[model samples]
Target: MAHQVSASTLRRVLNIWPPFLFAGIRVRALSADYHHARVELRQHWYNRNFVGTHFGGSLFAMTDPFWMIMTMQALGSGYIVWDKAADIEFVKPGRGAVAAEFQLDDDVLALIRDATADGGKYLHWFATDVIDGEGDVVARIRKQVYVRRKPPRDGNG
Candidate 1:
């Protein structure tokens, strides 16, 4: 079976969630095929720190989920996807709206397929910079995903 979920659907669904809505995450742009997506976090009291800057948890939250979801959609159902690991480096305090763009290009997809073609587990790392409205890097996030082809369902090992 092919992927029934579209980017628009994902965007719409995300827009209504508490994490995305109350936390001020906006799905700004999403490709039709789910290969790319852009999300922004607008600075608000709800997501601000005690010092009145953007909250670290909210900043991290805004950057989360895209990579894993994108990879699953791009690679389709034959592969198992998981967020193996992640790290974030905060470069600056986010004062205003911050945005992060997640992209999965053809080359990256090809690399993932090549690496996992033998049904062996493969790890793929993707990085994105969280930037403030002026385009200054507020944070950098690295996400490593584990992908492997699922074994046949007939109890074959």
Candidate 2:
């Protein structure tokens, strides 16, 4: 990584990011190793839809950056990671505070590395379930992440 920042610092920065801040999205916890993260969205007038429930965009936004960021951190600078696509299904009306947790397991990381070892790209799908305060699922989000091992650099600079 070009610049190394603590996981807690990253969490603070993400919490104040404009898209997240205005959407009432908060990063509740980010592990030191970036293997796990929790994010929440609180019901607010600005983030409510016409039906008086959580805005679909806000719900999706809360889970947006976690997978790609966490995967990148876990893989370090030797690999490239990108969010290729995403799909979100609204399962229920979101009220109060809804949260989503992201976890990267060792097996998944190993799979990514093995798949990308040949200098080819690997696409992995990560899932997140946004749940309400009562622990009911409010939405299901799927994110497709692309990873590839960075090619050896040619010294020219």
Candidate 1 lDDT by residue in tens digits, 20-86: 8988899998898778899998887788889988898888888788988888988888989999999
Clashing pairs in 1: none
Runs in model 1 deviating more than 4 A are 1-3, 153-157
What TM-score, computed on C-alpha atoms, does each candidate reach? 0.93, 0.96
Go through the candidates in order and give the C-alpha RMSD of each one to the true structure.
2.3, 1.3
Estimate the overall C-alpha local distance difference test score of candidate 2.
0.93
lDDT of 2 by residue, 133-154 (tens): 8889999999999999999888
The CA lDDT of each predicted structure is 0.88, 0.93
